[model samples]
Target chain A: MAETAVAVHAPGAGEIARKRPYIPVFVILAVVTGIELAITQPGLPEIEHSLRIIVLVILSTIKASLVIAYYMHLRYEPRWLALIPLAGLALVAVLVTALTATVAHP
Target chain B: MAHPDSVDEGGEEHHGSPWPVVIAVGMGIGYVGIVSASIPILVVGAAVFAAGAGGWVHVDMERPSRAFYGLAAAIESRFPRVSARKLALWLFLVTEIMFFSAIIGASWTLRLRTTTPGAAFQAPWARPGEILNVLLTGANTFILICSSVTMVEALAAIERGDQRKVRYFLLATLLLGITFLSIQAFEYQKLYFGDGLTFTQVPAHASEVNKLYGPTFYAQTGVHGSHVTAGVLALAYVTRKAFKGGFTKDNHEAVELVGLYWHFVDVVWIFLFTIVYLI
Candidate 1:
């Protein structure tokens, strides 16, 4: 009887496994893009130049994270797989640093 | 030939093919042409590459099941279950990260140096939203994001062995990708001819903007647009295969692999939209 019951439960398990939070993620992405467009429009509270830049950077980062973690299925993949891109980002960091230094002094 | 060596009863290893070599050689030639700035040499390389690619795609579509499927299945049994193709693609993506970094970093450096007071360049970067069709590009960004969702769903559908849904979703993804490229082409046309942003020029109204702006904008977004064009071609290939009932639940690595590339493009655009448009 237990074996038969286990067989009966197996079909439902497949459904549970395939479920992913895709639509909610899309909603969040669209909403964020809307906010990005809104915040950059011509007439608003004159945000400090630096603060506006910071906010845009942060928002873009959040949007990027959502797409990578969800759309790319990186969240579900092995954690070590992320190290590949991070390796390239390590170089990017150096480039950004060098560029900033040049800009500050040049 | 279904010879014993190529066909393991267990279907494990692939003595892959030589066509990829031809493709690589063509790309190598193209790279050389780029360095030399010779249009004829570049065109020849591109033609050869296209032929090689077309032949490879033809072979895959004709016999997608036997060699590729067995290889994918054999390699998927190991840790993480990613096929060798997927691993190779991820590695390729890493290189793309560095490539984009170079383009974007150089552009940003140029912008900064030009705009800085007492700097060498004559003018600043045009202000945000000044010379760009931000609203149109923003809509294009949304289109790309939507395509990403459709692409993921196509993979999901294939995983479920729903061939109809796979075909539908792939077709949807292909259409969305084409829409993106069309909008980009339109934007390029407008920016170049209508708005006076060409290789060595900017709008007269924005005469204070640096001359480097046009080249940098085209370089960053042009490379990205080319990537999207490649993605669309990939999508078309897979969509054709999916329509032919080529992928089943147990053997759809092509779908997944294409999804990986598509999503990677979306990820790049996510940042590109911010860096180029909003910032």
Candidate 2:
């Protein structure tokens, strides 16, 4: 089906078609979600307390980067374009730092 | 179909459209109404907003959605270039990141401070799966993830100029989005009424939970849910456009932009599910 679509929708001269592994990515996401649920299940705490959080955060970040880079096509667009989101994240870093300080003092 | 930038005879730039300005005016009126606490003013603003939105949709449905090759598109006339509209959307998303950060960050800080020893918040925090329906929301998260997949596939289809696949994938994405919202509505109904987790009410059986829990939960998830609703509406619009032969290989920028927003919403949920539901 993908081959058919790509052939029929053939891009004009300079337009590059994205050939991402859409289904595989979906499978990976589903698997990761399953793992997250499994780790948190009432009886099964395979991961430790503090490390559990780091694991979940890492998994979630991986999923988000997959969506942003592949699905959002940021990887394919001009590199400078990524600076926009990075700038947002930079401010967010400040926000998190200040927020961390508040949490500490509170 | 040639590249959008290629030369063609008499390619006079599109003049302009009035719908955007009208919508802005409506939003301005709505803002004033909100500030003044006037129901009539709010209703009037909403009416104007609806009328403007309908007018715009009607106008757009009449023709294939095209790149606005007008004065505003000139912003892209530089080097290492990106389309002006795409750049604008990216910048818009940057603000959205901070917006969600503020919401989630405040909730996190509140949770931390309240949980600390001898603070104003007296009630113990709800256990991981005590009151909230984690399984249902996990399923909802999966639905959102699937919707993100279909959305990107729809863009891929259009990029290849496969109109049929484009239409079907779009319709699938639209339905998936609707399914996600429907599940969320169901979850909300169960929590608010059946489980007694209301704006101002909490169940007697779960009285140990902090009062702030209900409100902060609603505020954070509610905001993100509203975004999903908006994304669903956009999907519906794009699906209709796909069916009407409104996009082609040469001019499918709308699909990409809409997909960007949809994927961003999914990205937001990725963190939200971890923060709100898991941890």
Candidate 3:
């Protein structure tokens, strides 16, 4: 009776019990961070400045997405809940665009 | 009538408190004070905010950290449901996303405008590792990432009713969070005093760097450090409660909420380490 009550009130409790790739995600984040440091080091074969920036941004985005998807459990959550952060990102896109325009023109 | 804090059929407590409103009022006043540059008003706002936080903590300290899903169920029967607190937390995170964006956006704008030629403050930006300690901050980033793993592991432990593992993981996470903050504090001290990176001036070593560099660097990393401090405090609270057995397998939403916040902070640092340090 108690178990049924809990299951009714708390949906997805079982799904959360399933094992996740916490260690693997951590390894990816750490490795990517190391790559970021390596690429930016002064003695490394000088990558073009613009290319470095693009690569760093892509790498950081990957790290952020992994953290959000696994550590924050957005991947396991209801699809709609993911929309909350995406909505914020949409606004961020707008802001970045505006800021980019300002910098390009001025 | 049933007492307002009475338990329902599912053994969930139902109650309302005024502390959230008080906190909001305090924050509203604090925002006003900031805009107007009123010191006394700001102090008053801080006092109110502190009081509200203290009162809420005191009220909740003895209660088991439980989920309130009654309203969620009644409101939505067709769609998949989440706990009210979790939904609210995600919404709060959305606002945080916008908040950090604005801060980063403004800093980037300043950097672009001042560093470009024929601009009002045309000065060169500092090269990577010229004025800052990227190596030290990179290590701190690793510490934060470790904390995120422990935080999730803690949640996973509690979900399995492994009370001992939950306590141990929470303790480990708390220690890792404290270490991250300590490293950041050390970095800030060294940067501010040893390197002369003040709000108004660049490091003496990097004299040719734009004056705005100091302010922008501190603003971005300092704001992030402040968020980490808040995360540490939240972790401390949850850790204390977990030690007191204030959570159970079915009623550990607080752990998940705090984990979400901790990971969010970690996610922010991933970008910040790249943007502020590596780039």
Best by lDDT: 3
Q: What are the per-model C-alpha RMSD values against the true structure? A: 4.9, 4.9, 2.6
Best-to-worst order by lDDT is 3, 2, 1
- What DockQ does candidate 1 score? 0.35
- Worst window of 10 by summed lDDT in candidate 1 chain B: B64-73
After superposition, the stretches of candidate 3 with alpha carbons farther than 4 Å from their true spots are A1-5, A9-18, B1-12, B75-77
Which residue pairs clash within candidate 3?
none
For residues A1-106, could you state the per-residue lDDT of candidate 2 as single tens digits?
2223223334451345554778888998999999888788798745676798899999999999988988898887767789889999999999999999988876
Candidate 2: the clashing residue pairs are A9-B160, A9-B161
DockQ of all models, two decimals each: 0.35, 0.42, 0.61
Quote the true-contact fraction of every model.
0.51, 0.66, 0.69
Per-residue lDDT of candidate 2, residues B1-279 (tens digit)? 222332234443243557878888888899899999988988888888888888887776655544442333344446344555677899999999999999999988888788778877556667667778888889989999988888888888887778999999989888988998898889889888898998766767788787778888898999999999999888888899899888887667788889999999999999999988888
TM-score of each: 0.90, 0.90, 0.93
> Which candidate number would show the highest DockQ if scored against the true structure?
3
Of the true contacts between chains A and B, what fraction does model 3 have? Answer: 0.69
Error of 3 at B237 (Å): 0.5
Model 3 RMSD in Å is: 2.6
The digit string of per-residue lDDT tens for model 1 on B231-254 reads 999999999998888876656678
